[model samples]
Target: MTSLPEDPPSAISEGDRDTAVQRLQEAYSQGHISHEELDERLHQVLTARTRGELVAALASLPEENAGTTSTIAAAAGRIKRRGAWRVPRILKVESAYGRVRLDLSRAVIEHPVVDIELQLGTGRATITVPRDATVEFEDLRTGWKDTRYKPRARSRPGGPTIRICGTMGYGRLKIRHAWR
Candidate 1:
């Protein structure tokens, strides 16, 4: 049998291609590659017309990062729990495509002025307001038929005042903290 040169043929060996796929899979499972990145890379590899291109793709493994914790709190003691005093007089909140809940069951007896902003892609929101506080609704934009306001039969004075700005796509929003 004749011995081949150190350099393999232009065609990629089955073992080399398999090893590349394995390395890519391991990188993804170990969280080294994001789903979008992995998909793009895999697409590039599988679509390579020549063996050299495939080999070049296989050699492009990204560097590993240990990640930083200066901005991340890993322990329970590092978390900040605000007392009643820190509660905002006017709670301004914003979100997209999801409902947000604000629980005031443990709130102090203080008049709160709340401002809410939501850019919902497709969802609903239900807000529970204490009785007696006045509410004002401002509709920025909505894809739904109309915005519905469901209020409690009773009202409580000196409660929270709610101001809402929202854009809903086939969704509903309820602001209950308003006093009528």
Candidate 2:
């Protein structure tokens, strides 16, 4: 006798839906899917009842990178990363006396979580994250100025989380979310 068709896949939970939505969003951001496709797949993921349905929503998307750690150091200049640059899983930035600007609004971030460790001697640093991202700077230590960040009341349901850590000696750090 058939074993009840292998007991079908289990029902998708809220966490599963959230994760699927996040994967869709990431795929859209990486230019893997169009806006219209993203919207359609988002709807499908949100309304999916079983794991199979949820998996179908993300069938053709490319797998995310395994991620690697990279470092950017400067003696007395500006460290800037903008445009459609690829963001690694872990980034270490060291500057003796220069400004750091990391614009992730249009960057390609494959990892769900990104950690930025900064060692600044002086000057200001401005980091612009994606509109739906979550910024965490609780582990940062500022010697001269405090981190300037205004957290939103509610972030997107399934957005990436950016963790900022390390030390800023006599410098200011400003973190802001990208504007729509």
Candidate 3:
């Protein structure tokens, strides 16, 4: 088997393309790229078959410069991001033998998409998102009962998208849609 030196093709997993999609959407929301450009690149990112192709989709975007704002809800404590608190671009929640609730139904989102990472240990997390918002939580194990997030169609533009990724052991994270 011979490989092309210029375009060395490698399998591009959905995870790889998803990261590129996230970057493209962020660039579009930040006004770094036009809507038409976003649509074009998004198509490429979604349909990319090779690593080279996915890499090209994000080749033009600037490096990630967005600052991350993190928080930890320790054991035996409860934390809530509610009321008028300004939503940060990146929010991290770590709860150990505690409970954490992020009520995004009333949160003032500063970005079109928010990346939230959770680290839970024998704790519980409840996320409340607005009726219009979409949540994508990857494979997560919550003790004996695994949290199952049904995959929906790719989120539409102009609405908030929250991507939650993390590792949990003997803990549970629940997402509830706004009621109203």
Q: Which has the higher lDDT value, candidate number 2 or candidate number 3?
A: 2
Which TM-score value belongs to model 2? 0.66
For model 2, what is the C-alpha lDDT against the true structure? 0.83
lDDT of 2 by residue, 56-173 (tens): 7878887655556899999999999997777888999999999999998777665568999999999999999977778999999999899999986556544568999999998899
lDDT score for residue 106 of model 1: 34
Against the true structure, whose lDDT is highest?
Answer: 2
Per-residue C-alpha lDDT of model 1 across residues 66-159, encoded as one tens digit per residue: 1211121121122222223223344444444444454433333222355545455655556554444456676547787566666645543434
CA deviation > 4 Å runs, candidate 1 = 1-92, 105-112, 151-157, 177-180
Candidate 3 lDDT by residue in tens digits, 51-75: 5567678766876655768675676
Q: Give the C-alpha miss distance for residue 35 in model 3, angstroms.
A: 24
Best by TM-score: 2
Return the lDDT, model 3, position 43.
89
- Cα deviation of 3, candidate 2, in Å: 48
Q: Would you list the clashing residue pairs of candidate 2?
A: none
